[model samples]
Target: MTVVTLARPDDADALSAFAETAFRHTFGHIYDPADLASFLTGWNPPDRIRAQLADPDWTIALVRGDGGAILGFVKLGPIDFDLPAGQPSEDATELHQLYVDHEAKGSGVAAALMEWGIAWARTRAAILYLSVFTENPRAQAFYRRYGFVDVGRNPFRVGNHIDEDRIWRLDL
Candidate 1:
């Protein structure tokens, strides 16, 4: 059985490693090697994960498989992207990252993580925001099923590379 739980400080190292691998498995082929390395070093380093784990404003939920191996995770936190004028920043939360291991696809891990993230976001803000790579139709479709709609496009930076990402929002 798989279990979903809040990420603890002790899980940082494993989470960091798992996050990097999951990201690479899904999107590494699209980026230049240098860019991918730089992005992973900055974003998935163990210290960074530890810091996030300690931050009261950030919430990371983990899906652990039968042997306690991480199968997937989702991160929820304050918005980091620029919102359009008239969008209430204080009323919005961000789904910063939602990833499942390649081996766990179709095993319901992503849905479980998304459910946990949405419930967590609902308690903190009236709206939820996220960004999906324009090329990733599967992720876009999954988000759409949760009532998320594309509001605009945003530039997502990975090292020196910039990719267009679709900004999605869900009114809680």
Candidate 2:
């Protein structure tokens, strides 16, 4: 079984490296390699991830394989963290990012990360929410398996242009 732990600031480099590799595998085909590289570099660059790692409240949960390899991680925070103007009800948890190494795929790592996040959030309140790209139906379906229901839609800027995102929330 994989054990999930609270990630410390020092883990930023490893996390960023994982994001780079996993991101390339996940989206390189959908976009020009150059575009994907540029996008990923800018978004999850060492500097950026390091800054987030230093945040006082932002949380990152990481899971490691039995041999100690990183399998997956989930970034979560108060709804207000990612959404500047997002005013959720009293009980709302925002999922910022979730990714698992491809080799660890289909091993229930993602579900375990989500479960960790939801349980952690429940300690803070009663609802869990997340926003995912409108184009990624696979992820939408995956979220559904955890009982997350689509509730609304909005456009969020990625790189330059805005893209549609579906909001899903589960009542705790």
Candidate 3:
């Protein structure tokens, strides 16, 4: 049976590699190879994952398969960008990243990770925030099922390309 649990420091390297693979599989075709490489190297390097693991504020969780291999992961933490004045609740945490192995699609791994992330946010924040690519209707629908509403728009850069993103918030 698959199980979701907190990620340990020793899992950083594996998580970094899994995240890179999952991300590339999900959105690699939509961007230039160079841009994808830039994003993978800059945003999800092993060092960054290690740092996040060591940070107390970041709650990183992984969904492991029956044999204990990681199938997916999620990270929840404080918002990284400046929020608009007087809009989002004061106690809000960001669902920074959620990635599931391509082979694990339709296995409920993503939903489990999201459930863990939402519960994590509930402990410290009243609202959960996330950003999804504007073009990704499937992901938007999934978030909507979890009560996330589009609150604004932002630009997410993949190398030199600026992709539009819809910011979503879920009130806990």
Candidate 4:
């Protein structure tokens, strides 16, 4: 069984470690090692995650399994990026990252995190949005199941490489 909880300040280290492992498990094969390393270093650093945990605008929720090990996490927050014209600029929230460990796949962790994120968004914004790599069809399909519709495309940067990512939005 797994339980979901808001990440605490002390969870910074564990969250950082789990995030790196989960990211590598999902996208390691898609990017060059150098690029992947650079992205991980900047994105999952313990200090960065710890700071985020302290930010009121961000919510970092974690899914813990047996022995209280983190199985997955979701980071949701107010929109900080520029949305294309026609996309509502106000009352927008972003599901910045949703990552699950490989072993936790098919165990309902992702679904739980997403459910919490959407519920949280309902109280905070009019719409919830997320960006998934264009090549990740499985993720796109999963988002579609939750009523997220494609709105546009955006450039996602991993280190110095730019990749196209499909933007999906769910109106709450």
Candidate 5:
């Protein structure tokens, strides 16, 4: 069985590795190798993960398989991206990253992590926001099922490549 729990500083290395692998499996084909490598090191490095784990404002939940391998994870934190005018940016939270190992894709891991994310966000703010690649229909549909609607377009930078991402919002 898989279990979801709060991430600790000690889990940073494993989380960082899993995050890079999951991201590469999902989107590596779209970027040049150098860009992908740069993005991984800059964004998912162990030191960064450790820092976030130690920060009070950030929450990371990991789904661990029976043998303690990381199967998935989700990150929640204060909104860092621009929000549309009139939106409650000050009190809003963001679902920064939600990823599942490729082998766990059809095993309901994502849903479990998302459920945890939404519940966790409810305690922090009234609004929850996230971004999804515009070309990713599967992810878009999943967010829609959770009542997250597209509110605007945001540019997501992965190294030097900019992807047109749709900003999604859910009223918690």
Candidate 6:
């Protein structure tokens, strides 16, 4: 059995371990090694996550297994993106990352984290939004199934790879 809980700063190390393993296994084949390394380290290192847990504005939640391992996490917060040349700005609470360890994938960990994130944002009167790599079709499909509709695209480069970021939104 698995349990979902709002992550506290004490779970920082566990969060980093899960983030590294899950992300490495899932995206290692799709993204360049160095870029993927930078992404994981930049976002979920223990120290950084500890700081985020201390943040008053960010909502960070996690899913844990019966043994109390942090299986997955979702981080959401208010953000303003300055649009590129023909785009307009948006008021958004971005889902920075959602990841589940291989052991926890089929047990509904992802859904629980997402549900918590949506509720967390709703309480703050913020709309839910996220950006998924265009190449991650499975993730895109999953988001769509959860009532997230694609509203825009961001064309950008990550390291040596050219990628399109599909933006999806859900009403709070």
Candidate 1 residues 26-102, lDDT tens each? 89999999999999888977787788888988999999988889999999888999886666688889999999999
Score candidate 2 by lDDT. 0.77
lDDT of each: 0.90, 0.77, 0.86, 0.88, 0.91, 0.75
Indicate whether candidate 3 or candidate 6 has the larger TM-score.
3
Stretch of 10 with least lDDT, candidate 2: 80-89
Give the per-residue lDDT digits (tens) of candidate 5, residues 21-53: 988899999999888888887887899889888
Cand. 5 TM to true fold: 0.96
Off by over 4 Å in 4: none
lDDT for each residue of candidate 2 in 46-163, tens digit (9 for 90 to 100): 6776677677556788998877667899987767424324536566778878999988888889988988988888787687878887888878889998899877776665445556
**Model 2, stretches more than 4 Å misplaced?**
80-90
Where is model 5 more than 4 Å wrong at Cα?
Answer: none
| Clash pairs detected, candidate 3 | none
Residue 59 displacement (Å), model 1: 0.4
TM-score per candidate: 0.96, 0.82, 0.94, 0.95, 0.96, 0.85
Backbone clashes, candidate 6: 0
lDDT-based ranking: 5, 1, 4, 3, 2, 6
Once all C-alphas are superposed, what RMSD does model 5 give against the true structure? 1.1
Error of 4 at 31 (Å): 1.6
Candidate 6: tens digits of C-alpha lDDT, residues 1-172: 4456788888888888887887678767878888776666675688988887888778678876667777788888755443344333344477878988887776788888877788787776546778888778878888988899878776645456667887777876
Deviating ranges (above 4 Å) for candidate 1: none
Model 6 whole-model lDDT (C-alpha atoms):
0.75
Worst 10 contiguous positions by lDDT, candidate 1: 83-92
